[model samples]
Target: MKSNKRIILHYDMDAFYASVEIRDRPNLRGKPVIVGTSVITTCNYEARKYGLHSAMSVAKARGLCPNGIYLKVDKEKYSRVSKQIKNLVLRLTNKVEFIALDEGFVEITDIIKSYLSYEVFAEKFKRGIFKNTGLTCSIGIGYNKLSAKLASDAKKPGGVTFIKDIGEFADFISDKGVKLIPGIGKKTQEILGLKNIVQVSDVLKISLQELRSILGYNRGEMIYEYCRGIDNRKVSSESKTHSISNERTYLSPLEDKEFIWSEFLNLLVKTHKRLKIQKFHTKTLTLKVRYLDRKIITKSKSMNITTQNIETLKKLMLELFEEIDLEKKIKLLGINLGNLSENKEYQLSFKNIENIKKERKIQELKEKINNFRKNIV
Candidate 1:
């Protein structure tokens, strides 16, 4: 069956941070573990079994698993280990792409053919990865990125699995939730429930238009193609994010205009810090908000010059936010920077030095805001 499923592999480290924490402290071996930058990082399988996950707050984590140990991320050490791991992976194939410090995708179909002893090859590769990085990863071998990712996840944490033939495809994925299909999120799943389609196999029977009308264009197309285990995206090679932005999901719904402005300021500051490090800029800042009942609204305007200053952008964000009447509390708020362009020095106008200085002040405030938010939640 000439399916679009490419010969791809999804590689993810098992409880990456927790494993690293355990590796460093042998004493932590038998205990449930948590390792993350904030409260949102890696939690051990034991904690996961208790319904705690990557993004859940630490306070919430403790409630679910009182015995779980928590530790802050040691990024410097992780980076050092990741570099060593990358070297070992390069031994397997030249087409390896590292998506983050711990996760990667390697295209190894040709290498698999060359090895002949694939299980031996897998074992050696696994050993090499572990010996070098002190991290255990799950490897999924499949016909395409999607299937391969799913396969890798079948057996986790120092586990490897293969998708040999398509006949067993249904069996492999039959018990999986529709949410695992990538495109079907919580909102979409509810929509699907209304329509009586709830499984990977169930998607095969829905008309494309029916899927499209319900999920919208890109997500619908993604479902239609992915159900057959087809994903054409390459190993997701590293690229500069096209735009930089930040958002806040209010701790609780908020309607206070002043409080909302303060939140926007904080976000702008954080986003500016990231933009500074990446050496990128955008031509526009977009302000977005959602109401308690799930009503979303957005506004955007282009800047005359490229900048990522928090103070400058906050003025714009507040201007946009203020335009919306706030009789009700806001459930979610976000900011987006778009119309990206590489950095270039603009010709400063002498006719408007005060205006230029004021503009520069906005940029400076953005820088300050970014710095201030670094240690904040």
Candidate 2:
């Protein structure tokens, strides 16, 4: 019965941003190294000892560990390293879903069949990552994604944990708090606490109908199934891109409207270029602004028709930007072109015929410019 279960592996890099910094600068080893500016993105285990963690305010972290070596995030360098690690895992199996820059789920049901055991394959995978990237990751193996993720987080730095089947998973989490279950946040916990439902075992006592009544239909049903260590979510290796976006975080907050608008325009052009290259026409434009206080606000607008025209997109982006309150000094600005469609003829309108023709001509000219630029480079 245990052999019939699907084998899912979840791999998470230990203190990803901090680890990369330490790997590059060996002097940072054995020190409390922190990453990010406004908030803590990640920190080494040494920094965690001082009660510092991701999302904690930089001011709070400084108060906790005044002597910690704080550093800004280098996303481009980290992305390059992430791609290298991803390529290595792809060699083992193409069935990988990267959930974040430093963590992902890989279905190794078929791969382990060729090996002696799941443990053997996990160990080999971990060693391969370290050998190539000089970074350590924890691997968790289980019958489903939920268990695999939890198992990986149970051990830190360099650890491999395997939960063979549903029975083992149930027993393992039986005594743990309901918050241990993914998606059960503070509000949900508060709701459950009102009913004295605090632990996995406590949830097991409630009837399916009762749980449904408590948490609403969909969420309640999902929680009821999860309490029994039952998860039917499949691992998807989706290659199709759904959206294109670009953003910039400033070293100092900007209060000038002209300067901020100029920065946003640059991002919009870059994102539109990528959209055109991918042959995707977007109908929606979104503007994201993060203020000096770390509060984020976003506004979105959808055009009447899909388009690949940067001019039309620029107009829409400006409309969305105007909807946001720019009274506060901003630290970050971003643009996201979404509601993407690869099929160009999906939403053709006779009213926009003239505009469409103009867009096509502009696209052709842009392509020529891009080709010429590439040749010169």
Candidate 3:
């Protein structure tokens, strides 16, 4: 419905990791495939037909879809493709917030249903992706980010979901599970289960005070409002980089140099992808380690050049992670990129005046480079 507030769009890459896998291996297009390491990242809709989905136990997933194929995650490839997708979206709106590796919220202040009609956005985005690197995305449009996300998720596989009026909110969420709201984890769901809170109406039936008593004040208030489809958070356009990082707590703590090397590679690749997509370069790379006792250690290194190159990042990460003793149970590891600069502006300033002129010219060139991904990823 019409509102004076911001028009937020939630865009999600449908089964992103799986979609990318299918893009690379065309033969897997209609097949069921799961991408993950120790857990299932997500299974294709085809796999879903056999009762497969993200976070499903691997053994159960295998039992559910005996014919499905499983692929180990390729962080480098996924990160590269994800960057391409982000580049496409950034071209649409300067104000965006990434909520996950594969999902984001775009605030359309200057443009809305007119410039970015749900239909046009979907077709253009899907086309752009297909033409550029052969991938797809699903988009949701609403007056708010949360609603838009629900809209996008209502459909599957390169579809557009949108709501035109706030009056539709009740009907929209009527059938949704209470767990659909953010912050309602499995544990919360179990508690709600005891209260017979399986649906939105179930939450709506409870008073704010009672809900607050169970879910804590802040979270309870959010749930009450969300159940009634009310949100006031703004979609900010000036979301400059404050921090960018990639982290993983191990399935098991091990000191094998080879294993650490591999994990470091994974974290760096993911972090670098985030850096490139944001169009920001960083001079300081921080390495983080969490010991078994939860003691944290961090190391920082400065680079003469800011980059997103995988090989360079991998080498840097290796050197940084190597400083830690493997004998200690390192349960968690991460790579952080800070000391930010706009990759373009930083490069130009480091060079001469002529290069500054060249840099201005290259802004268009960079836009051209991402033009293909600008539509689809």
> Which candidate comes out best when scored by TM-score?
2
- Tell me the tens digit of each residue's lDDT in model 3 across 32-133: 989876679887889889988888778888888888899998988888887877787788767888766788888864565565465776677568766876
Q: In candidate 2, what are the lDDT values of residues 213-251, reduced to their tens digit?
A: 989999999999988888989888985788899988887
What's the C-alpha lDDT at position 375 in model 1? 57
Task: Please provide, for model 1 over 1-377, each residue's C-alpha lDDT reduced to its tens digit, 9 standing for 90 to 100.
Answer: 24443567778888877787788888987788887534658887777887888888888888888877878878778787777777778777778778787777888767666676546666777777787766688887777677777887888877888875565566787666688887677998998888778887788788788788978878888898887666677865555577777776665899888888778777777777877777777678888888888899888888767765667777777678768768888978788888766666555467556777888999999999998899584
Distance from true location, Cα of 5 in model 1, Å: 8.9
Model 3: how far residue 231 lies from native, Å: 1.5
Per-prediction TM-score to the true structure, in the order listed? 0.71, 0.85, 0.67
Backbone-clash count (model 3): 7
- On lDDT, the leading prediction is 2
lDDT of 3: 0.79
Candidate 3: 10-residue stretch with minimal lDDT? 343-352
Query: Candidate 3, residue 57: CA error in Å?
Result: 4.7
Q: Model 1, 2: alpha-carbon shift in Å? A: 12
